[model samples]
Target: MYKIIIVDDEPIVREGIRNRISWADHGFECVGVSENGQEALGMIAHFRPDVVMTDIYMPFMDGLELSRHVAEHYPGTKMIILTGYDDFEYAQQAVKLQVTDFILKPITSAELREVLDKLKVQMDEERGHLEHLNRLKQQLNESLPLLKERFLERMATMALNEWEIRSKMAYFQIPLSGPLFVTIATDMDEWPSEDQGTDNELYSFAVYNIIQEIMDKEPDSAVFRYKGNKVITILSGSGEEEIYTLAQERAEEIRASIKRYLSVTVSVGIGTICRELKDIRHSCRASVAALEYRLLIGSDQVVSISDLENRRSKPLYDGAESENSLISAIKTGSPEDVDRSIGRIISELQNASISIEQCYVRVLRTMLAVLQALLEIGCNETELFGKETRLLTELYSFRSLEEIEFWLKDMCGKAMIGVAETRRNISRNQISEAVQFIHHNYDDIELSVKMVSSRIFMSASYFSSLFKAHTGKTFVEYVTGYRMEKAKELLKHSSLKTYEIATKTGYQDAQYFSVLFKKCTGDTPTEYRQKMMVDGA
Candidate 1:
């Protein structure tokens, strides 16, 4: 029920209003009675009454002054003024204070009840409207992330004009505003088996989570999954070189985290940095093209288009097809495939009817391709070719096509082998570091896979897989087993109570510790202590 306060100078008037009205029947209760507006202001502050009825003429403070104060401080509270016929003009002035209603002196209870009934309906309607607005705000907040992702994907694919891009970016609250922008594309080097549908989904989800978590730390960067397989990230900064460096660092961290936690490798490709917002789509395309170079570069590494620009030499004799086939074969195919690809390129050169000088240029271009592949796979060219022999000068001296083919085959074969060995030897040091961290921090009650993984700069999922593979137990199982062993030692040898032992072993609840102890060791903490003592005796 809404509460009400009645104020009047005369004692009889105050008592009559309180005792005469059946307040509960009219959906209100008379919470207070005051002799003047002064006392009623104090009552209003304490009870916070929804409706206040006051007399127009009262000692210390009048009804008009009280109405003004209530209108300013308690705008939601409905006010009614009681006035004598002589004070009717004063009642008219109270209307300026937004008084809900005015009753002449000696008013009937029926008239007052009608006003109270109307006020109750107005309050109920206002409350319902407020509740509806709050729900809409909550729903908008919940769907904000999905909406932002869709807007970013659209921006990356479509050629939106600058005005449209700016408007949409503002609407979605995108933080990017770039004098320089770079896009990075990432995907798993190899997908899980088709039959393991659930595992594939989990791995994809974990990869996205890792990228999102890392990108969240960098300002003006956004990461989202595209077409279910690839993750696209866009980063904006003030300078071109700074943004490129930042992108490379973040991409490498993403690659390492996925490899460390998921036990799987991912390839990252970075596009040329651009200045205009509309050209982000171009960067997106370039990044995907760079990802294709993973066939030559090997996986689980960052490949930037800018890095390839200086190393790659255009085919000198329209042998682009043959050159591409040779690079692919050397990186992925067997030794025989490399030999056949080289022969195809030589035949194309021989059939061109070009001069010996042109032939030399084409052959040098092919040699450059070989060198690029070797560099991509982290091979030291100086070691492969002795420090004394300049590869290009030696290639220039070779007089016959057959001689050049033999040399090309030998170099390409070794490059293919180098690529294979490098991939096979992807580092396992991250897992070792994770194990050391867990052992050192085992007594921390908040110790977790995420905490340990973060300490070693890896993703939690990747770290969990490596931890399981290396220790033959999940992170929680290993930590719990270690804690139980420590608890067992303390119970057997020390006089500490069970609760104290629980605290030492990283458990906050002694009762929970006792329960888990019995589950793991087939005896409660106290029981285990007694059994050990008896057996020793």
Candidate 2:
């Protein structure tokens, strides 16, 4: 209720005015009556009244003085001046104090009712205005996070000019202006298939918050959801080694936090520290590439461009020798040998730490080489590489290293069986024995035309000529191809090192093995493995 106080020098006048009106009808309550303005001051403070009525001609602290004091201190407390005189001077002074109303006393209930009704309307209007402002303030607070996230995303990706960037930065209150930047990309290591209905948005939001909590400690950093399961973090600073170390440390913390709190593990890929925002895309690609490499590295792994910087040029298996062996095995109708050959390629590929795309190229080359050699051996291309898109169309689409490896072995073994059934015999006894002997003892670096000729009790020169004539290749060519085939088998099927593959393939020097393999197969051992292990899902 709007509480009111009535004050006058005459007790009768105060009581008469207080009782003249039904105060409740005007949404008011007269809680006190005062004989003078001095007394009303104490009563007004105690009651905290909304409106006060006091005589202008009181003995001490009259109506005018009370209104002036209340207007200055409790300005919200409006007051009315009640007086017997029609004093123009008092009216002017009441205007100065901004009194609610100047009244000629012997106050009536009807005039008081009109004034109280207007004051109620004023109060309600003010409350509505305050409520609208509070609602706007609430909405702005809620939208702030969404705005900041979008702004950070745009700054990381959009090609905004300096003026535009600065203007928006100022408007959105972003403090980032990157001359250097580091980025981290994350992917959930494993999400259960049954949890497809899990709150992805909630999880992403929680993950983003965790990342920011770790990263923002270093300042000039932000986190955003770049993909469904991927949260990307960008940190701005000098492109220094310390900056990288800091980012890496934060990445480790982020990984641990998510695992501990979210009940899931995430693999993190740290990008190259770009020198400027304009080159940020390079860092983004580098981070994503690092994440993709984690498919080979495994779950909960953190890969950085810096970690792979020294590794990018390392020796990958050149699948040439492996390729030759596979083709030779396919052409020789030895499904066992062909299986060994494919296994050798897969094993060699597994030994290297190259990207999936690089592995894909190697596997594609080997697959094509096998097809090529099969074609050379009179195998039908359509029969071998069937109309089924699963082989060629979906070759790159295969997911795991094992899947591609198994697929290759299955296809090659099938082709090898075809070669065996259709192969026309050339010098049935002698050539067959030589080929078998070569396959069994190709690892002997001393196995040569002389040794083989001696085993057969034939003259060296005659045997060499006859062997070339029957096989359509020189004796040395046949032996090198056989040894290379053996080397490929060991490389693909076993965990043998390159030097071991070399010695087993009959080369005294591992470098010589690489050289020979390159000459014959058009790729180094490491290059071959890098191309074949293939790729990720």
Candidate 3:
């Protein structure tokens, strides 16, 4: 309802205006009546009426002055001026003050009714507009949760390009930008069994609410379900340290709350800070990767990639480069070469000047890599790494790295046997066997690429790639290198002539062997042997 205040010097006039019209019919309430503008000003402040009607000639403050004040301060307050004869000039100023509508002296009920009807219509439109804005705000609030989940869930699972990220960000009205996104993967420790009989949805939502209550207090963050029993929270802030601090603080709060109230343990895996939203999948993976350390670090702990990285005295070598060969070697190489290959990796770690702690970390990494490769080849983790498997417990119990190293070396040998039993992850194992064949037959003068590929049952084209993957060299390059090493061994330790050495190392034509040997080792067989003799002397 539109509220109205009547201001007049005459009491009768104020009552007459208040009672003359049916205010209810006109969608108005006569909230107050006053004898002068001063009293009416006080009423206007208190009631905040939408419309005001006042006589021009009042004590203390005239209606023209009141209209001027209301027009200046409360511009939205509509005013209809009251004037009598000889007050034509005051009416003129009222027009300049932009009063709503004015009536002359001896105001009639019909004329006042006409003004009230128009004011009622104006208030109706304004209130309806306000209601519309409110409805839109409510709808937006309802849809915000769905939009957040869609974007967060997608980011967690897949990689999005820059344009797609920007467009979705704009569409969802997320005010945050790139250069500082941190993903934290939070999981409940022993929760699946703890809450098995409870309402899953209610239980999850309760946990979610606790998550939001903890994470949303950060500068900018979004919390959503990452998967069953896990929720992902991505936070955006200024610097890497600041982001880490925020995520760490929030994670502590959540952990404490869950422990104190919920009686269950929740652990967090915080990733590295991403420089762009499009690359945030890396952060998500890192956070999840941090979770992989929960078992080593202990459950219900908050771990960061930096925390794990700091545990090691040096950076980890890209074991991925040698992993395929390691797996391949494990599958087909002799027990000695298999041990040597795993030793080579550990040797690399050992020579890097790492601390004893780093030795433990690298040993664990080596074992996990072997296990993951086994799993990739189609073996169940439980069969190999399940609770019943004593390898992990024994691994943790080792006192010295040499003992641990020896154990891991033997484990790799056993794992190769276990992996080869399944035949689950092959295609690359064929290349390993092809490599094995090449190593054994490099001394055969008739050995060729086609012959090796045929023996392995893999096409030459496929074998080429897998060989490069496993050996980091083409098949011909590996064969030649092996032959050159053997040729060098003969030159140093045997009295064999150059031509005899060439034929022994699988070269039928001595001249071609000389050229190939010179190309690979920068020396002909004779020159290499002479240099070896002099060095030996």
Candidate 4:
């Protein structure tokens, strides 16, 4: 109910008004009755009443004066002026104070009740309108994250002008104030499900959650999920080197956290730094390009575009195809393919009627390409070049084209050999690590080849092939054999129940474990235990 205060100098007028009306019926409660406006003001300050009814001619602080103070301090508290016929002029002044209504002396109880009823309806409508506005603000807040995600995706892919970018950034409350900006793209080495079926989406969502949690702690960094399986982050810093270092540190932290918490490994690719807001798209493109190099550098590590910048040079002629063929052959082809690819590149340069300087630049570009391919397979320049520290100066001193061709072919051959040997060592080490991981986590029911491969930072398919070649069995076969051997020891040596043995061996279903045990040993668990007990006795 709304509260109200009544004021009059005379006792009879105030008492009659308080007693005559059934205030509850009009949706108001008369909280107080005062002898003058001064006393009523004090009650108003205490109760903060919704309505004040006062006499105009009260001594020391009249009705108009009180209404003025109410309008200034408690504007929401409505004022009603009570006046006599001669005081009608004073009531006009009260109207300027935003008084609700004025009643002449001797107002009937029915008239007063009508005024209170109308005021109640007006207040209800205002309150309803206020409530509606508050709900809209709340809904907008709830959807802000989704809207910001869409905007960030667009900024990474689309070419937006500075004004459009800044305005949207402001609207979304993104804290990307960068004198220098770098973009980072990250994704799992392999999804939980290799086929990328229904479970892929769930795994990606979990990965995004981990990434978001870590990135949120970084200042001036924005993180959001891209497509379904990738996460994109933009980081801002004061200088190019500072931002690059920050990006690398954050990427490593994200990789480590995902590996630790989710049992998955993620590879992060960082783009070159850009200084302008509109150039963010360029950085984003560079980051994606860096991810493509994961095929050469191996996965589960951070790759930066700047690291390969020196190895790339513009093509002097139409040698792009030949260059690509040479790099590809060095990575995966036979020695004959490498020979053919180098011969083709040399043939093109020999046929071109270019000057000696152009020839030198073209040959140097090819050498850099070979070096880049070797680096991808974890081969260093010292391994390929040996004691020859100044390979560039030696290339410049060569006189005839034959000398250059021989040098090119020799480097390509070393690259091919290095690629093969490094890949072999990498595979051996990865398989060994996978086995050790399985040994430690064998009791986990959720363990699988995919999980173990991710922990070792290799793709599931590649890990499977390598695991078989090294261990002479498929991943499932090896893990099962080990678990079965463990289960047999438990059944024969201990008094544990069949179900308890099953749980200890990583099987959630005892019936399935029993069937598998019988299939592998030609005896059920209980029969095996009984036989072992009798043999021992």
Candidate 5:
């Protein structure tokens, strides 16, 4: 029920109005009656009624003045004007004050009920509007980051002509004439899911605050939300050197501040400044590419295109150099030749003034080139990458020449190992049947290669060779690795003791299980569990 207050100088008028209408029947409670507007205003503060009925002419402060104050201070409170005088001027003034209802002398019950009913409807409509607005806000909050990501992704890959690029830039409020640079940031490590709590909101807000603070330190600088954890900038009225210095200094500061304040790792990649909007895509690509060298430079490092030297006309290995050469070296199986190849690539890059930190990046790219070549030859090894292309697909994002070189080399080594092992194990039935055996009897403590082979209709000696050929793993090694992996999971997620965990992973002897766990993970099950708990995982 809505609360109501009545105001009038005459006691008779107040009593008559109070008693004449049954307020309860009209969805209101006449909580109090006051002599003048001043008394009513005092009651307004304390009672905080939803509706007020007041006389026009009262001693001290008048109703018109009081209505204006109510409109300002308590706009949600509905007002009904009460006046005995039949004056058009008073009615006009009341309307101007936004009085909800105007009832002149001898207040009728019908008019009073009508005003109360109107207020109820208005309140309901206001509530509905509020709820609708809240839902829209939630949707916008959830999708804004993703929408911005898609926008930037399209900008990076699509090749728009000069006129079209400028038109688009103008439409998006991007300054087209001056030096432009892009910097993309990414969250490096995963945070604990449960421990994050409400920290994600604060984390995002802090990232925005840092970007704003950095931009504020520069002249004629603009920052835009590029994507999640990324802020892009366009600095006008500055030379390329000035832009580069500002980005490097600010990125270093941001990295340090994040470590100090948020305790998370972030890497910033700065692109070269370009005057043309058509070249902004190159700047964006360069910024993204800089991130690939993070493994060598360390997390939170800022890398630029200028730091990497240009690539040579031909690959270190010429077009005539076959995969067999690389494979024969691996199968001779000397780690020394692979190491020497990697060393020469590094030395050449360094002599050309390329950064050593870009080595991993070169490795990644070479792997992709190798994968592409293998694909052309109809070689399928999708399962080697956990049956996903995301890891390989990201190679195209290398920014610097050094980054590209390092990624290529890394990719080459990984692919060589992944492909060689995969090719060695290519029998379908043997692998399929072995997988079935492992799945069905994974809980058996006495499960072994001998027991599995006997059940699957294969001799023990033949099964060992066939399993290795088909799965790139001997029977004993495969089962042990699988069991240890399961044990790791149980130790991390469950409250089970080491003995119980050993049993769960098919080990009857807890001591033997502990020894194996230590060998696989460099920590006992208890030690691993303790570390996970400390990390709040």
Candidate 6:
């Protein structure tokens, strides 16, 4: 309802106008009655009426003067002027003041009703427009948070090959003309919470404010909320060095700003510039991978991929063959051979300039390779893990390859520790023979546990337990995992239909294949492919 004020010098005129007609019926509430324009202006400042009805002639000030003040100060308020004399000058003054309506003196009840009815119609129209605008605003407010969430989720999970990424650039409406670079801002994994809590809105708002502050300072730049803590800021027509320097400087500023407001440390990884959005994901991947180097560099630091050189380019060792022999000797449990191999492997890695971290991974890979080869040479699988198989399962989360190498180093030390107390232990060579058989026949759709058991001269039940013990996976799980990995590679690289890929992966049923793929990937194959395309676009 529009609040109304009545202003007139005569108390009777004010009373007549206020009590004569039904203001409530016309969607108005008469809140005040002022003697003149000055009093009405004071009332307006407090009550702020939507419509003001007043006489042109009054003490202290007049209706025309009040209308002028309302027009400037409260522009939304509408003014209706009242007058007794048929004065052309008064009418001209009301027109100049832009009063909404002009009613001559001795106002009739019917004339007043018509004016009020018209005012009600105008108010209704304005209300309708306001309601429509509010609906749009409500919709945007609801979707902005979800949009930010979906954008982050998409950025975090989708893995796009080069072609899939290019297609996404065309589909998702990202700007593709300028040089694009990705900046990844990722939070470290903290202690687990009971809620498994996710505050998409708060994090998104923080990221948005950080980007906005940067763009606010540098008006010429374009910044977008790419995904999660990651934001893409494109600076056009700039030199690479200047762009990089500016980004590094702003990253520090953004880090400080986020810390002040959110109390969380954010690490930023900057990528090399690419000319299109299609390759921006590659840049994004590069930025994220740079996080692996964060251990050497510190946290809350801005590390640019363009700045780091891979230390492995320089050779640290002479004989790759001797390193292999050293690795091989250790697996065979020959103390003399193990000593020779350990020394050589370390020397080769040290000479190669491979970080202890890199050397560790390389050593683990070498150890696993030798372990696999030992099974071929009739080593017992049961002899590998002792009594506890779960220890093998925990190896997946080991940080640096060096960590695994150190574990192996410790394993070598332990094996040496017990050499004097050891009882006779036979190596399990049959498990490796089964693994070899599976590797050769995994593509066969009709291959079964029965066939493999018969071929390896073992009972089905015994072979099943042995397979699980050796691989930390059941026979069925291992084959399925292997096939699905192959299936994914084909789906990514080839234009095969769902049925063809299913068949190629040894799944006879396409629907079943889709179900399994979705179960593992959290997206159906079609949805996965479409999303990959969207990313490329």
The backbone clash count of each candidate, in order, is 5, 22, 0, 0, 23, 22
Indicate whether candidate 1 or candidate 5 has the larger lDDT. Answer: 1
Candidate whose lDDT is highest? 4
Model 1 lDDT tens row, 339-393 = 8889998777655534445677788888887788778877677766668967768
- My TM-score estimates for the predictions, one after another, are 0.35, 0.42, 0.38, 0.37, 0.42, 0.42
Candidate 6 lDDT, 381-497, residue by residue in tens: 456556664433545444333444456566664444333223222214577777788777777888788888888788999888877887899888888888777777777778899
**Per-residue lDDT tens digits of candidate 3, residues 259-296?**
78777777788898888887778888888777756544
Please provide, for model 2 over 1-537, each residue's C-alpha lDDT reduced to its tens digit, 9 standing for 90 to 100: 788888888978887878888888878899999888788878877889988878898887888888888998898887788888998998999999998788886767787778778877886677689899999999888787777667666766666666766676678776555677888888786554555777666777788778878876765776777745678887777658777887788888888899999998888999988775656657777887787665455568788877876775546878789899888887777778878888888877777877777888888899788777767766676775576635556666454566677888888877876676445343345666876787788888898888887776678898787788778999889988877777666655677788988987777899989999888778888766555555311
- Model 1: how far is 171 from its true place, Å? 2.3
Give the C-alpha miss distance for residue 437 in model 2, angstroms.
40
Query: On a 0 to 100 scale, what is the lDDT of residue 52 in model 5?
Result: 90
Candidate 5 wrong stretches, greater than 4 Å: 1-50, 55-69, 83-100, 116-154, 171-173, 176-206, 216-222, 234-246, 256-265, 271-276, 292-298, 303-537
Q: What is the lDDT for 150 in model 4?
A: 91
What's the true lDDT of residue 303 in model 2? 84
Task: Return the number of clashes found in candidate 4.
Answer: 0
The models' CA-based lDDT, in order, is 0.83, 0.77, 0.78, 0.84, 0.69, 0.68
Candidate 6 minimal-lDDT segment of 10 residues: 418-427
How would you order the candidates by lDDT, starting with the best?
4, 1, 3, 2, 5, 6
Looking at model 1, report the run of 10 residues with the lowest lDDT sum.
Answer: 421-430
What residue runs in model 3 are displaced by over 4 Å at the alpha carbon? 129-150, 157-182, 185-268, 271-301, 305-537
Candidate 2's displacement at residue 197, Å, is 7.4
List runs of model 4 lying over 4 Å from the truth. 1-318, 354-357, 388-390, 393-399, 453-462, 527-537
Question: Which candidate model has the greater lDDT, 2 or 3?
Answer: 3
